[model samples]
Target: MKSSPSARSWIAAGVRHELLTRALPALRHDMAAPVSVIRMALLMLKRQVAAPTVDAAACEERVALIDNQVGELVLAIRSLRDWELATTDDGISRSALVGQCVMLMRSAFDLHGVSLEVDAALDPQEDEHRWPAGAALRYLFLGAMGYLHDGADEAGAIRIEADGANAVRLQAVKRDPGTSPSVLDAHRAPRALAIDAVALQSLADDLGYAVTLDGDSVRLVLATGN
Candidate 1:
């Protein structure tokens, strides 16, 4: 059967539209690093320009804004560095990796007067299969809560449980019970949340896990059986 001219035109247009939509995103991502450099240069130019306006408070506010932007840029650079260090070409136990992260946050725990206890005790000689990389976010966020809510005295507690298999959940408790979800989740942006959400999402994306938060409880569920 001969296709109508309008039908043929629609098919051609759809194909071209799909190709451009996909290609444009790829092209933009490839150019992002250079574009970021150009943006930094422009910000520097603004900082160097002669000050025409004379309000001291306004100048201080601009300085604060620039400092915050620089801080975010620095954090992105550090996250890239962490991504490099987190991988091991050879197999490494997931438990050991999580232990290392706990040790790294040990000082923070002490500073906040929080106690950390791990329920998993494996024999040193036992050989368990290594889990996927990037699951350390659960540990990182659990430890961070210890540091963030340390001043809550007897009110703050962090509990982690393994629901058999690959499911894990971390629960943060406050005795006062007045803490709102906003206080716990804190970060309002879709791309930005509390350190816990940020780290959890990163690990979820890498490891194909489902990470979610409900009220004050945060959970990470690994999808694969093996």
Candidate 2:
């Protein structure tokens, strides 16, 4: 009558796969516009620079804007690559993963007037531990950022810290006392994030991690062994 632990685990993995099928596409869609804009801007900038009569000031402004947009595009692409690696069960360094996530969300945080910080506490010796790459971790990071972005007060800050030796703990805290305590919910997510909170939570559960919301922070504990 009751399902065994192994059976439940199997079911959970299946659910994660299904969620991924939906979530990945949504993520790609969210990223498409930015990528397109960057491509177009680059082409236009190239033509402008090639023109002999280009205005120096106008060229400088366009160059700056292109540089900024390119930076954002690079972050998004890195995050997408990481997610792909994770889905394929590839291995990536913990520091690299966290760094990518932070970079990927940095622009969004800046747009919302939220400060994002990352603290890497692991020793150099611990860098040998390779994290199991997958959408679960990516979802966890993005979901936390989404929650913080929505709930944080103006000029609020988010702190992302990696702690622990054998088992790594990744935490994101919305560091404003005025921030509203909010759990990420699919129904409440903005139209921009097509993936819902339930799918993100499901992926976390399937990956043997729990996303806990305490006050204004979302914490995910990851076991190195997987």
Best by lDDT: 2
lDDT of 1: 0.45
TM-score of each: 0.40, 0.50
Give stretches of model 1 more than 4 Å off: 1-88, 120-125, 134-155, 175-203, 222-226
TM-score of model 2 relative to the true fold?
0.50
Predicted candidate 1 versus true structure: per-residue lDDT over 171-218, tens digit per residue: 555544564544534432232222434444443444444666665555
Q: Write the per-residue lDDT of candidate 2 for residues 1-226, one digit (tens) a residue.
A: 9868687667556544543443465456556867777677778777888898886787677778778877776776775555442357665565655665665666555544566776646323453767665455665556556655555444256776665543334334444565543521322434443324554455566566767666556666655223
Per model, how many backbone clashes are there? 0, 2
